[model samples]
Target: MHEITFSTVDKPKLLSQLTSLLAEIGLNIQEAHAFSTADGFSLDVFVVDGWREETEELKSVLERGILKYKEQYLSKRHVVSSVNEHYQVKIEPLSNCIAIPSDGTDVWEIDTTQLKTENKVGSGSFGDLYRGTYCSQEVAIKVLKPERVNAEMLREFSQEVYIMRKIRHKNVVQFIGACTRPPNLCIVTEFMSRGSVYDFLHKQRGVFKLPSLLKVGIDVSKGMNYLHQNNIIHRDLKTANLLMDENEVVKVADFGVARVQAQSGVMTAETGTYRWMAPEVIEHKPYDQKADVFSFGISLWELLTGELPYSYLTPLQAAVGVVQKGLRPTIPKNTHPRLAELLERCWQQDPTNRPDFSEILDILQHIKRK
Candidate 1:
């Protein structure tokens, strides 16, 4: 086995990107370890087999792969500075970032002093999720990392708070309140003890038998229907964003990239995780609420198979195949016919050809009865 190591500035999805790079270079990783430095750099080491070549040749190939990876994933609309011979993407100064509108009301403003953080549960490039208490009630707090906070991050935070404050539904995570003030920005919601469906499936190796799968699908469909009725596009609809409470009722969570549908009823901006993104959105074409339906279809497949959408391909490669080759995950042969049909309708290339969430819910309910 050959050991490979990579060190770079820490960023969102960095580990996934690195793993993808190794896969592209024909490495079968046997073990991996990651560490983050106090100075915000990440060090990743991998033990792998599959390169039976000379050490110098392997080194050359890996260097080429790293260069290509940097160009494709790291240098998007940002200046690059070299550190220790590795390039780091630099965000434009805070002044260059657009200012967020201050038109929102402060009715849900929370007292930060009353907030008690217990432990960190998860983290992202710009924020960390914590399990905490508020007014003696268990809550989940998503706080922006102080060092990573910038104008662009703040704008997203403001947008999440703006949309979440108005939302209430049995299938949607309840918005408790938000600390919108600077340096302590956090959005609080009811704690989801059961965690995300993504973790349960991928991390815990949990399986959803047909009955349980349909129930989960119905719950997500109800939640998406509710959001659509409110003219809100979740934009990112995947297992990771679907959380479960103590009672095992799944609720939609995470609105950091969600937005109110524009008055014109179509949006052109491309934003979402590529693995589950709709083709129209991937191509940067104007899309409507039906885009969420496409993602929901992929999420449904994820639930059915307990696997990532494109396990063998990188996210960018999967996106390219989705838009150009009309690629989709294969449905298992034993899948219920009606449910399989519903999945096909949801994956239709034309947005208008897809079934709405209401129809999807009805179909899932029918399957549950059969």
Candidate 2:
């Protein structure tokens, strides 16, 4: 067993790059585990069929691959579609240098002095979230814990910030700016007064009528539709990641685990809370935007019933049941027939069978009209 561990900014091509490196070094992987840390680093461990003599060669090849894909790993250069607007992000090879956009874009480089953090709103595997004030506007600030801040972590944070800056949708959280400085790395976004859907359902014991549930469902579907249309996969879509404004309109938040789809449009990584995770992701199978649809189905189930999926089981148990037993949250008998059918379609075992959010949005809209 060769123990190789490295941290890099999350990217779609990362797994392929590593496997290619191993093959070039004449090493066959016996077993592999790859997952993303909530703090924005991809951690991969591989058990390979190899000997001691090839260890040095394997390291060399790995280094070369890292160098070749340095930008993809460290600098997430945004695709600037405008012909006249020329900007590209570049990273110094194997160094802890910050990425610089050749031609500056609208990504705000926030001065730490301008941010005034208030009370702590919540905490997660990534870090603590706080309600803050920036530029006289209320903002939700996600401050990555000190120990989690590293060179690769910064790169990932930069990627997410730049990506959010490019996205514009009412159902998506508004990105304000980020303080990229170490020991205080923070992401700022427009504060959602109603908090997350998870909190609304679980913490507040809120009960949603069918029409209200449909409205929330439609908001999420619209936001997810926009994300999918942009070729972005929200690898960790869940009720906890869905925020609600004071108007009760839902917006998609938490892009720490999100990634731009590669040319092949397939991602191989088990990322997301296990309870809401797609079976493909749970099985470490190649997945795409359809994974998000699976998660949406779970969220819809939660909305309709106001209960957690597999609440009696631990995360590991839920994952096992989902992968081995094809366990899905039960849709209440009273649910609208159309809505029930929609949920069933979203959580189909075959990814291709899952309806795209565009189709889901139409179904939801039709239900809302009644």
Clash pairs, candidate 2, are: none
Question: Which ten contiguous residues of candidate 1 have the minimum total lDDT?
Answer: 79-88
List of clashing residue pairs for candidate 1 = none
Candidates' C-alpha lDDT: 0.81, 0.77
For each candidate, how many residue pairs have backbone atoms clashing (under 3 Å)? Answer: 0, 0
Can you give the lDDT of residue 269 in candidate 2? 53
After superposition, the stretches of candidate 2 with alpha carbons farther than 4 Å from their true spots are 1-97, 100-103
- TM-scores for candidates 1 onward, in order: 0.75, 0.75
TM-score of 2: 0.75
Candidates' RMSD to native? 8.7, 11.1
- Could you give candidate 2's per-residue lDDT for residues 203-226 as a string of tens digits? 999988999999999999999999
Q: 1-370, model 1: which lDDT tens digit per residue?
A: 6666676766656656777877887878665544454345665656677887776677778777777777988664232221211122234344422234445654577888899999999987568899999999999999877665655467778789878887889999999988766666788999999999999999999999999999999999999999999999999899999999988999999999788888989875446787899988766467899999999999999999999999998676787688889999999999889988989999899999999999999999998988
